[model samples]
Every structure is written in structure tokens, then in C-alpha cells.
Target: TVLYYDDEMLLELKSVVISNCAVGHGGRVIIPTEIKEGKLIIAVLQGEVTVLNTLGERAAKNNMVA
Candidate 1:
């Protein structure tokens, strides 16, 4: 699952992908450590892939439009 956090709220999103990156792929969750420079850094617990908690430019643009 991806932990989505902003200034207002924290949301737990399961089986999500952002910026062409997959979160909790193959049922493995990369443990989130901290947020830096608009990216949430995660540690590898049992997987080879690392995913970040980023909203991506497209999502940000959409949010701005909305």
C-alpha cells in the first residue's frame, strides 16, 4: 500500500502506481521512511524495487486545474 500524505490528510492507497512506478507490487510493500523534497523515501524490506510517495507532475497539474 502507498501512504499518501499532504498538509491536510493521510490516505492509504493499495496497489497504486504513480509516475510509472508501482507501489506494493507483487504484494510486497516498501517501508516508507521519510519525505524529502516532495518525495517519500522508502526502504527495501523484501523487494528489489523501490517506490516513492510522489503525486507526479501530471497529478499535480490535475489538482491545480481542479
Candidate 2:
């Protein structure tokens, strides 16, 4: 699942498959763009996740703090 927030609203996503995504500010999580100023929280309760950016590069696997 994913969550997003912008200057106007907030969004929550689930069962999403993203390739080359982008995310903006206000906690917005964009798929196929640049991830600007937000936080990505992951909970591996059952499986693992692979995140990719617009550059077709894999996102780092690390704990992040906004």
C-alpha cells in the first residue's frame, strides 16, 4: 500500500505496481516521477517491496525519516 499528500489533498494507494515513478511534497507519493519532499514508510509484515524511480533505478533499502 501507498499514501500520498499534496497541497490540496491526501491519497492512499494499495495493490500498486509502479515503474519509474515520481512523488511531490506534502507527503505525495508519485509513481513514475521524482519523489520530492515526503516520507516513505514500509512495513514488511509478510513480504518485501522493490521501489523504482524515474531514472529506472532501484530505490535504496533503508529506513527513512521525514
Candidate with maximal lDDT: 1
Per-candidate RMSD, Å: 10.4, 14.2
lDDT for model 1, please. Answer: 0.40
For model 2, the stretches where C-alpha displacement exceeds 4 angstroms are 1-14, 31-66
Summarize candidate 1's per-residue lDDT along 10-36 as a digit string, tens digits. Answer: 332223233333358576544434422
* Residue pair clashes in candidate 1: none
lDDT of 2 by residue, 1-66 (tens): 433334232333222334434456865555443432453433212223444332212233232423
TM-score of 1: 0.18
lDDT of 2 at 17: 37
Q: Which candidate achieves the best TM-score against the true structure? A: 2
Q: Count the backbone clashes (under 3 Å) in each candidate.
A: 0, 9
